[model samples]
Target: MALFYKSNNAGVPIGWIAIMLALLASMGGFIFGYDTGQISDILLMEDFKLRFATCETPGVVASCDFTVVREGLIVALLSIGTLAGALIGAPTADYLGRKYAMIVECMVFIVGVIIQMTARHVWQQFAVGRLVSGLGVGALSAAVPMYQAETAPSQIRGSLTATYQLFITFDCISIGARDIPGAGSWQTVVGIGIVWPVIMIVGMMFMPESPRWLAKHDRIEEAAAAIAATRGIRKDEAMSHPVVSKEIEQIRNHVQYESKMKGGWLDCFSLKDKILYRTLLGMSLQSLQQLTGANYFFYYGASIFQSVGIEDSFITQIILGAVNFFCTFGGIYVMERFGRRRPLIIGGIWQACWLFVFAAAGTAVDPEQNDSIGKLMIVAACMFILGYAMTWAPGIWILIGETFPTRTRAKQGALSTASNWTWNFLLAFFTPFIVSAIQFRYGFVFAACNLLGAVVVYFFLYESSDLTLETVDQMYCDPECKPWNSRHWAPAGYESRHNLVEQTKAAEAHKPIVGGEESRREDVEKSGDEGRTERC
Candidate 1:
């Protein structure tokens, strides 16, 4: 209810190396956002409709049921493909590791992009291309956050991962193309979408695999080297650093515990395991993000505005795009400084208010005759977007990334991301029908969903902000852990919360130089033992 600030009391600085890795992994998000934003406007284009929708006239709406169905499929198939990608990306990420899995995503996205660009037909080939692109989107969406969260320090993990959505908002790039004419422009824009994935593929060639993943795999030495590279420190120095060594130890302990316990989808549903609780929290929140009618604004912004009697929905969409883009910084700052729980609650309330207002305004007057009511609808829609952009949009990614223990992170992340796209596909596919059936009252459905989502956020969501990944693992293992009361929580002894510089200084000062290399190794091991004890 009040401002909850989680600072880096440990004085751990996020180095440029970590930032570089976060940014590179975030290219997947760029592709995700670009595809969503690009399609929103392109579906209305004359050439797009002619080639795909088979409509007889330029700038005319698809009136028949068949045309509407085709349009929906074109828009929704990408999500279908993404759904598949999330499913496959899970095991792929687990088996191949995050970096290589993303390289595969890039290749998939490239193939999809080429198919979409070259397609001369509508439902069959065009839909196939979209489904392929969605596969890339799904994989990237699953892999990027997992990669970023594992690589990042807990202090900035929220903001670093939120950069994925920031790229989504920045994906407002092709909004300008709406002003340009012809199908070639759309093709060129789709081609441009290929650049970010290509960047991800090429850039990942040089990036380190997740250190936590390596530690889990019993490659402790390589994990230490990766930790060193991530912090721009020497490998020997990293192996000896108390904080880095503690991180490795924590990863090892959690992985060991997970290995001892059998895991599967059944494990995720079992009341015997606290992990199932975390899984539901993440999956539900991700589902809520889409159900809150956020994508209705995204996938069908023009249609929603058009239904409310706005003549030039394209320009208005561009304006909303800009609004969505800039407001996301507020989310990033909030996620970093204020933690995750409060912003979500606040955003949910704010969204419910705007959505109800939109519904009221939509029904208040004839959009066909009353221009003022039409303008109000636009205003209400923008406010709704503003609320969503700052809260659920970015917060869902932050939650999903940090929610599960490393043992189930990939598979759980895949399930959570797939829930999002599944709901996304449903909303994108049925929005036209929902809009037609409910008319101005559709906002009411969204408003009610958001209000329900807030209750879930308060009762089910826990605070993981500013906690080390290792500490979070402990939070779930305890029998007394409660989702509703986690804001005031901390692991006993709290070793991971120490000042990084102080810890390093103390470890260095205790080095036994008289016994040479073996003594130094013993000191490092001793410090690591103490760190584990303090953390537990």
Candidate 2:
């Protein structure tokens, strides 16, 4: 059962199976992105209007479009549902395990889709269906990444976890291109997402469970098998494999540390352990990710383009979506190539500059009357998308996954994600009114947010790049290691882990043991300085 593999830049085994597992888990993002982009086009479809967009206000003569409240409710209800779901997702993921939690959420999303498909009667039906499905989307957002972050090797974990955002950007572009030029039953758009969750269920059936999750639940044998399967190690020697052995030790040690603290939700906010600081940091990052205004376009791109006088605005939207999608690959590269804060801080200033131009261009003329504003807005929008996709979109998710300790990751992740949805909901609900009142000036608000986000990031967000998650927990434990100077900080545990891994590598090649073989096992188990060495 030996499977040969090449090592990635991070020296982890590179196997197609592991890659596919990340891709499959990332289908949750596919569904989420579809829902975000799908409705933007659907809301503009004449068929949708004919069926559900009758004037809520008493108009004198003909039927009219949905009232502001109704439209806002339709779009924002999902976020509300997701808020609850993100909160609930933590316990569900913990109780059920990451793999099965995803399966269950996928099913829930499908059932919500069924309800959405049947909604020809009124807008409420469709909106309710969206709200119902959001529960799954929200939970999947938490669980899928948790699974990916847990199972992926540290070397490519950022790239692998960023696949979730990749699916998001990819599908948002794909949906905008596929459905933007068409007019049909909105149900078709709703139904298409069912395919994603279905794929998730099928693919996950064959995937390994998160080894960390198994370890957390005290399933050591199954955890080793999971490591073996994912890392391409032989199952017989998987437990004794140096990397695997060290990883298992770290997980056990961390879990025991957590148990000793006996922390719960309150612990997440308590200053005594500095958990409060991390909770706020994760929440702020998530909130700022939304405030960056990328979702503004995906959620309402058509309306924005139409306001700027592009008659058939969908093509312009498709171009922007394409840029957003392609630049996200650039984001994956940035995640691997640089530390976390620099890109985001630079992207913030970049987005702010473009958004300022966008607002100024819109304010300089009547966008409805002047043809030039169209090009300017598109240019500005594209620039904004480029910066955001490469930085905050993937960076925030990557940060949250690495920021919190394993003991509190699920709940704390939900808190930050809930912040994402809350801001998402606020912007979704209020943007129409805001855009109508100030028009392009609305860009200024997010531009300001982007700037503030940069400053906050400079002062607060810890750099976790290139460090393993276990190393991340230990790094955060140090009182002296603040965000400003964290790049130079490494926990002693990290050096020990690296030394052990190097020893394991030497052991693999039957290289001479530095202190002979008899004491190696004792050295590892007890950190005993006693003169002995043993086989890895």
Candidate 3:
């Protein structure tokens, strides 16, 4: 029962650990995709019809056709639980640590799976198991990436974190493949959903605690040991590495400093400076991604296909899943190379344009002529997928993790993630209403949202590529650089743990350690100064 650890030694190959951890934790995303994707197919089943008919009001018979009203309510209710879980997850992770929070989420997921598997009624399953699982998925959506980002070495952080989306796409494909026979046997399809979280729980038994969490809790030695074990390094070698030692030291100093600051929810809002701006930016990024109508496809793809007169909706689901998978790879390849902001700007515009085309096709075509229009909309949808797969989806998480200071990282990550789930709920809940109300014009709503998202990105977001975390903070905190200013400052290598120690030492000379607030101010000032000085 040896625990896995990340290696601190140079050239020891940390990529494998990164990939392994990413793949394991990403089971959360898999659960999300499977549960969400399976619903569309389940709604098409005879079993679902029979179940719904039993609960129908008196003479009201349930229809075989999937109604946007029922579909939207189910999806929206799941999101409601997700929103609550996400909000709670921040505090849970902050207090219990990411690993333990994930463990608890596993239990929640188990409850959800069992309920969904055995439920005799659709409403019972939806109200009980689906909502329970949604809570687990929502919390994991926030926690897993935070855990991975905190645990992953800086070199491969983006790729490792992006694996969440990869697993999500993989889950979509798996669920779709399982449903190829259509809604006739939803029991089999829904049953497959339990496999992922069960695997994750088993994996958790083998995985080590997050080193960053260890560092935050004043357990430097344990943190170092955990890193060494996970990275396959000798404990002594890991402890001796200057980079590892420096990071551990900085974490200790940062945590000790935070211990003094008046810790409360108000603190997140009180900082009207750059920190506040960045926090809002992160929250907005998550919301914008949802508003762009991406998850709508994941949740309602089968219905969308049905709308286009496709007889075999499961086939379309598989195609969408494949398209999502490759398109996400396209995003991964370009993220680091081109930087964060550019890809988002470009991708947003492209997505907006294609959404309009999708809308136009959907609106203009009659059922008889849907053959050509459906083909066109499918291509347009793929293009939209390519645009989002390349930008926003993965990049937003990268920016959120990197933009915040280590002191507030977990809390901010949680808050922004909660915002994401809230918006997800909004979209999921309203989408059926929108589709039913507008009929073929639903694509227009998505197109408009994408356009709005594009505008927001262009005006509010900045380039975060190649800049170390510390440097990015400086760009936000520096008073001279107004919010509207377009000036870009090249940050130095201040992100290295060794550099932080030097900066901390320099700060110690200027101010006596009176309390946590004073000490934290000193660290923030020092980190900011270091970033500025290096740029000069």
Candidate 4:
């Protein structure tokens, strides 16, 4: 019920510290966005062509244009690495702790940057470097947010974490607009992408560990200390609050119960129907975000502009990047105030409309006609970015983190994140083929996907804003929460074992009839020292 930990004083300056740390840590996402957007410009470069030139046969004069195949291969290789990393990152995060996982990812990222920056051969060595960097990005996408959310106070959590998405949008815009004014100078753009990971390594060096992770490990005193240090509170003062202490105890208990309930992969499949549905929904949303072809705009906008006969195509890529950066701010500003559902609904409809307009422009407009159609297509692309920036891009991650119960949160989050990467791999890998088959008219396919996604959101997704974690679980499990079944959403058929109301009542009922309160207090004092504490 309390908004913040008791140890947090009325005027404590910890909020700013948390925000700064989160911003720095979230640079990983910026690196991801930069690399993704940089591809558009990279492909347009003559150097890109020279580096990847292929021979017709061994020692024969090179016949295949290296530029075209090389660009596609680099992008595809990165996506493949990301797919592999996403699957690996989840279990690593759960086992090694989020901070350590990030440290590992940062090292991998730096190595990739070095290889890419210095590489001469584009075949085997270039692919290795791209894959390494992609691995870092894939893991970082999952680890950074999890770390930030666990460290943040619940009150300002959404805003602080949303910064990750904000930075990514900005990075995309920056990469698109960045130019070194040479024909084969895309290396400058690639170098710019390295800055984010460097910032992440330095920022994370000073941040405190996640209190929730400590608590889950049954290290109560260490968790308390982390909570205090991160929030700038005294340890005793933090532990003195009944609500804070209770939540800590609950986390510890939940983790212990999970250890006892551990089973094989089959057990994960044996979960209740509601659990399965929620997991699938989270995965579906993540996949849908990619399938909508948003990345095509981010990764290939410059090429698209060139196809439309735009002058200074790289400059247009930069402008599109700027649009992406600015519009995503709209999503961040309104996320908490407007809540999740409204933005998603509105954004979805907006995206569908913009996609249709874009498709129509591509279908109807001639490249030689007055330059008007090209401008119109540009506007439509900006609108699509606006819609995604505001809704599906960041909102899907938020929903995934908050949807599952604590017992299943890590595993479900991992599975959902992996699903996203797998679909992302497909999109990035096959985009070239799609564009080749459909020509520059791939906008129509994306428009259709957006329409389908909007329909899915309308029927399946529910309002989640303003609800506590327990309330969300109940909403999904209770038949009354099923659409068209209840006048008002509530837990209907399922027993509320983990419901806050029931948990509180049960806790109260177990209060000793005679001197039980005193014993409970003593137990709390004794168990406080039995918890884990580790410093990186």
Candidate 5:
């Protein structure tokens, strides 16, 4: 909280424009989180279970007779649409700027919500509705963070991006809505989730386009204006603002370099230039982020509570949601302070330990009779959520958002998000069966998965702290750079050259010119082009 209010050493507070971008973009995250959280509670509803009934076992209650696979399908349908949307959204985001892509996502979400709210007859309609809604969810997931990353300053980038997860934790409030009585309550939950997306669409109309995206397409004037607006400076004043000028120069340099490369989706897979290797690492990192098995807790936490003989599982969910929501603050703080890799390794270890405790407790005590063990299981689950919310949940997005170069960013974002959703689909699809078949022992599976994730983090993950996005790009572009070797590596003179660009701008700001403003503009543009060539 103090960090949000504090200014930089030069006494410049973060501009409201950058803050607004983060806030509006994060609404997409809230909507995504709401859908994720709501479904778990909906799944526990008797009405929702009966509406999607596929089995008819004699003497079984209608809800009780719902088959495991069918229930899993109902819960997992959203991820299927998410997988498709994330794959296609990259090309769409590149074609349409990030802001408009988000607007398009909102419109799709509205259509999906209408379909869901109006469903009268069958389970298929409900599933179709979830799939449609998921397409929008997937698109927003890919676009929003990319937009936020491009807009934020490097100093607070981790915390600002982590706000996406903070807004996600806001969905915990939706858990309380589950107690709404009557058969139509689930419909109400679905309808209510639309509020944040609507706000996001309207609010985005007033935000600036990403400066980096503008520069990528050679819209230099617009890019400068966007940077000016983001910095709360006049267009003329922007040329002398050291941080803004340096960033604009770096973006221009990167874009110029990209223009010389073969820019296409398939270019991302070129092994000759090591693009393929970098892409694979990003995709695998995302997969490991999901395969950490966090969503299993999100999707089936209610059932886990029930297995431990807690009668009012909704209340338990509320408690869990609160724990998740509050603990996320710890995550936001450590992300910038600890960098990205170490905290993840530490969190994975914590998650594995708590899950093992939960599993062992379940095995040792009969949940139906042992109140103390039931409480212990709940505590362990909350502890697991704490570890995850503070680490992988926020850290993965920050790392992924900053990983790829501008040329391959959208495609890599699409690929990375697609990998995440694919694993999400599989886990959501199979979790019920895993829990039912293994009972308490299912905890061992995720515990082992967390251990694997920790091992991966230790061996393969690299630290990406206090560096500009351009420098990070250059690091990856180097032929000698590998994932494990990144910690010790430094690209030559990029920082000093960046400072020189800023110093030159500040010096020129004080000079008198015969050609006036237009002449200076031409000189700046020419200098930018030459700098691009020299840097390349």
Candidate 6:
């Protein structure tokens, strides 16, 4: 555990271009956060309920009845749709390339948003719209991190990929809608959703496809250009830049090795190299991330506080959103400066403590009888949120993004993401009933889950903080490596602990660049023979 601090070295800088691409791809996450966040407020809106909520007094906003089942469906259907979309998004990313897959998902989101916006009165129609829109969000969620992890430099990959979750927590615009009731057509609020996806659709045109995706599909020249773009090196100089050459070599070796091996759900679980254990590990972590209970606040924050006798629940949700938004930056900073394992383990325990306290303070005393108890509930909620935002929220994305091998990255990442949405759907659908039955007592269940998550991390999750993506694959490939003792582990033949930094020092990877422009290949090949590239 002490070695954790020693492994937090920054490896190599790729360039600003990769960061820009990651941010642009993260627009999907922004859209996901905003659209999902607005629903909590919209569900509380009397006008919104009058229009779409099934109610006893349909025409009268004051006397309207909001049934829990209908309310849950409006939120849950999006998760269901997202689950389906995530499944489809993976193969689409494999077939169409990450850039175009991004465009496709954005378009899908737009169509769903239009459906939700234009719904005249039926809640079912709106739910259908959510399902449609979820397809896009689910797909983009799968695609964005894959794109970021594949493109990013290793030392910063966790931070960059975790930005997806950062954008997911950016509920600023939507959370503010509660106070702006008279601003415009509330129907058009869903229409506002299209703006994010539209921006991404255009942005993808200028961005590079994931170099790994291009290489996997055998588009070698384009892959070289993409690697060049990410590194901010000239296309002709790409094969000569040691970092670029080594990355291409790694990608090529992985794809080639995967070609000779059988892959699928069956093979993935064959236990030949503990692939099944790893697969389950990734997906289970994603599922556990959702089960950590932060969504309880985001999805139903307004109602949760209102139940505690807070008149202005929107203010509290906004407070929570602000806390979530800011803590994500700390999460990014800590993951890069401290590595992944310690923060996640510590965060889980921190969250468990607050969750237990929150549950006790909320349900242990009658908040209705004691004003101080209600206030304490809010404090506990914020602290619990603070832990979630800084740890499991961002950590899972970075872990899964870098965890799976390139061979199974798209499909396996899809399964991982879909696992998240599956739990999301269950929570969205069942939370109302659970709350009605136990109210704040629900926190205890999540508290237990968080405590379990820490144990799981300690026993299973290896530190992937600064390892190159392929080097991570190499870590899992080597049977000698142990998760708990991997703090100083480097791949075979590497002097430096960080594989990416070793590449920068002109270490040889498996092979030279091939099938790019002949001149570029010749330069790279000649340099490979000379034991280093001259482009640097």
Model 1: which residue pairs collide? 81-135, 82-134
> Model 5 lDDT vs. the true structure?
0.75
Best by TM-score: 6
**Hey, what RMSD does candidate 3 come out at?**
7.3
Put down candidate 6 lDDT per residue, 230-342, tens digits, no spaces.
76677787767665776687677667766777766466566655677788898889999998998887777765576566667567667888999999998888888778889
Residue-wise lDDT of candidate 3 within 17-131, one digit each (tens)?
5567777987887787777766766765666655653444533335344455666666566777787787778788778888888988878977887777677755656556778
The parts of candidate 5 lying over 4 Å away from their true place are 1-13, 46-65, 173-184, 307-309, 479-490, 494-536
Query: lDDT per residue, candidate 2, 438-486, as tens digits?
Result: 8778888989999999999999887787665766766676777788887
Top candidate by lDDT? 6
| Predicted candidate 4 versus true structure: per-residue lDDT over 429-532, tens digit per residue | 67778877875578777777777777776677765543434345546655546533322443322123223233232332232222345543443333223221
| Candidate number with the higher TM-score (3 or 6) | 6
lDDT score for candidate 2 against the true structure = 0.76
On lDDT, the stronger of 2 and 3 is 2
Best-to-worst lDDT order: 6, 2, 1, 5, 3, 4
| Residue pairs with backbone overlap in model 6 | none
Residue by residue across 190-280, what tens digits does model 5's lDDT show? 8988898889989999998888899988887778777777656666766666546756877887788778887588988987445676678
Per-prediction TM-score = 0.88, 0.88, 0.82, 0.80, 0.86, 0.89
lDDT of each residue in 1-536, candidate 1, tens digit only:
11112232223434566778888998888898888777766666656666666655545646412366676777789999999999899889989998899999899998998998988755578678888999989988988988988888666789889989889887665556655667775787788988998888888898889987887778888887777666656667777766577567766766676677766655666565467787788789999999888777766666556645555756656777788889898889888777888888888899999999888987777665766777777788899888888888899998888887777788889889999999988887777787888787988989999988999998888778867676666666666667666766655423232333233333333423332455435433443343343322
TM-score of 1: 0.88
Please rank every candidate by TM-score, starting with the best: 6, 2, 1, 5, 3, 4
Show model 3 residue runs off by greater than 4 Å.
Answer: 1-15, 54-71, 172-184, 229-232, 301-309, 364-370, 466-471, 480-536
User: What are the RMSDs of all candidates, in order?
Assistant: 5.7, 4.6, 7.3, 7.4, 5.6, 6.4
How far residue 184's Cα lies from its native spot in candidate 2, in Å, is 6.0
Which ranges in model 6 have alpha carbons more than 4 Å from their true place?
1-11, 55-58, 175-184, 307-309, 495-536
Pitting candidate 1 against candidate 2, the one with the higher lDDT is 2
